[model samples]
Target: MAELSDGVAIRTITFSLLSSPGLFFTFLTIHYIYRSYLFPYLQPSMSPAHIGVAIFALSFQITNGIAIGGWLGSYGPTTSSNWAKHDLSVYLGTAIWALGLGLNVWHDDILRSIRRRRGVVEKGSGEKVYEIPTGGLFEYVFFPHYFTEWVEWAGWWIVGGVACPPARIFLVNEIATMLPRALQGKRWYVSRFGEKKCEGKKAVVPGLI
Candidate 1:
């Protein structure tokens, strides 16, 4: 029910737009546009469960976005200079977001290139298969993308501050979903290639989990 002053609201929105989550969301929109529409990559035919999960994921992001905006709008400006007010946390979040996005894109490129080299193609069933990625973060984590995503959200939470309820909600939801998926990916890899091949790799986090 608390509302920021008009001037404070304008400054907050401006800062938020220039921050990590905003930049990442912009990049993600473009990335998906290219991946889903412009690229000639074979699309996976989604199962019903997959569709449901995708919907839920999209919905969650939208809800989190709204919540974050509302939370920011309720907070007053901390300093006269807008940049100085959010400098540290915003910059930290941006760095983490950039790293995560880079790693995710790099990993995907590796997977796609490997599939191409192996002559893997989509079947009539609309399923494409890829070999296990072995370099970079993949060398340590079974699902490096997932791990990076968590790191990105951690940065977002840091910028949003612990006092923001919506920020906490986003962090918790992300971990709950991504952790399970990372574990599932690990299991799949183990089942396909045997435990010997995946012996040293952790599920999502390195060495800790």
Candidate 2:
């Protein structure tokens, strides 16, 4: 079997490789919440519903992780020889992933910058202020970050190829969960900024919701 950069045998797209991007994304999210949102904007508290949803989502993700790990390690053993043939896919997928990651960070930073510009909490009164974000894909979609994330995982799917059911399911699940949230976010933007300002923008996709 061919050895990957991690010194793991590249039999199939293993859990570590498939999961690394997700872990990185999670890291960024958690850091953003703590470093920016949580301390500055939100007062921390726990609600029953919040705990329940967190547990629910966590369980589902854990299940997906186990399934994906199991499949690649045992159920589907892609040979090193097979891996060699897909070199082009590796490079292409990496490029796609990089592009998606770049856009996601850039757009998310735009939103963060907007919030930070006026300070997260107003000085004496302590009112949180918000403004419409601009830059990058924000011009076309209310949630450009969401769309870019889907693109990031699409690259993961492509790297795994057609036979990778685990990757396929993960990508599908991400869309299913995030799509509604994006739509709701669009409604919020419309309410905050007005229908006229939000007229041309879509929920997550640019020009096509």
Best by lDDT: 2
lDDT of 1 by residue, 29-63 (tens): 55456556744444223225577777987887788
lDDT of 1 at 110: 59
Per-residue lDDT for 72-159 in model 2, tens only? 4545434455555655665676677668767776776677667555563566558767677778888888899889988877876666
Q: Report how far off residue 16 is in candidate 2 (Å).
A: 10
Per-model tally of clashing residue pairs:
0, 0
User: What TM-score, over all chains together, does every model reach?
Assistant: 0.70, 0.74
Give candidate 2's TM-score: 0.74
Poorest 10 consecutive residues by lDDT, candidate 2: 39-48
